[model samples]
Target: MASFHFELVSPEKMLFSGDVESVVVPGADGDFQVFAGHAPVMSTLHVGVLKIAGNTNAPQRVFVRGGFADVNDSGLTILAEQAVDLAEVKSDQLMQDIRDLEEDVADAKTDAERARAQAKLEGLKALQLAVAH
Candidate 1:
């Protein structure tokens, strides 16, 4: 089977770097899949689960808040604002975080503030779902 190099990186450090048969990303428009020799493209990513397949050791699942994906003949690179592996995620803590963000959203007085809070809430929701799956 064909495989491609995949790298997930955040400002802090590189999260995952390995070979995978395929990967599905939560693009801004919708979900999209990448495979070996996929056409070169770039996209803005959304907050959701990044599913990677064909790792003999284990399947990889990652939660990303938002990012940009750069794909080419060689591989795929993700530059994310925040990213976390499923195994390291804490569901209960994420729930608490969501609750806190909800409170902030409720208290937001300005439209801009509310929109910011709403975006955070959505990201938290995505994280919860990612962890669950």
Candidate 2:
């Protein structure tokens, strides 16, 4: 299979930089795959797991909160708002965060706040499901 350079970076640091066979991104509109010679495009990513293939070891799954994916002549570059490798994630902590978010949603004073909290809670739940499998 053909490979292409891929980079995943966050505000804190660079998460990944290497060649990959494919990458499944969590685009705001929907999920999309990038290959070695994919068409040039830019997309806003939502909260979801990024599936990466063609690495040295097993396929990787990384949780990304939000970001932008830019695909050009060089390769694919993702500037994530936040990202964490699933392998390094602590289930206990994730559960705690979900619990806290639930409370925030219930205690929200405004509709906008409630909606934001609810959306985040849903995103965390989705991440939890992905981590379980």
Candidate 3:
């Protein structure tokens, strides 16, 4: 696969900055991938996983709350609202996050709100399952 400079930034710090072969992001509409020479685009990300594969290390999976991804002529940059390495997340913490999301689903007032919350819950569950094994 071809490579391109990629950066994943959060409020706290710059999580990853280097060349990567592929990046799969959880876009608000759906999952999409970026590679070298990809067309320029700006996208809003949803709560889900970002998979990074490259030459620097083994593939890494990151959980991002919400964010934006920008692909330009130079490279791809992801400005995440909140991001964490799935490997470092404790089971208990993940469970708490799930509980919170569940509450959001339960507290939703309208059908649209409930659907959004449910989508978030499902994404979290999928991430949890991926982390478990």
CA lDDT, every model vs. true structure: 0.88, 0.91, 0.87
**63 in model 1: Cα distance from truth in Å?**
1.5
- Candidate 3, TM-score vs. the true structure? 0.72
Ranking by lDDT: 2, 1, 3
How many angstroms is residue 106 displaced in model 2 relative to the true structure, after the best TM-score fit? 6.0
TM-score of 2: 0.78
Ranked by TM-score from best down, the candidates are: 1, 2, 3
lDDT of 2 by residue, 1-133 (tens): 9999999999999889999999999999999999999999999998888999999753399988888999999999999987878998799999999999999999999999999999989878877887897
Q: Which candidate should be chosen as best, given TM-score against the real structure?
A: 1
Candidate 1 residue lDDT tens string, 14-133: 888889999999899999999999999999998888888998653388888888998997799999998888877777888899999999999999999999999889878878877777
In candidate 3, position 97 carries an lDDT of: 88
The TM-scores of all predictions, comma-separated, are 0.79, 0.78, 0.72
Q: What C-alpha lDDT does candidate 2 achieve relative to the native structure?
A: 0.91
Candidate 1: residue pairs that collide: none
* Deviation of model 1 at 1, angstroms: 0.8
Highest lDDT model number: 2
lDDT of 3 by residue, 24-102 (tens): 9889989999999999999999878889988556339988878899999999999998787887878897799899989
Q: How far does residue 10 in candidate 3 sit from its true spot (Å)?
A: 0.7
Candidate 1's C-alpha runs over 4 A off are: 56-59, 103-119
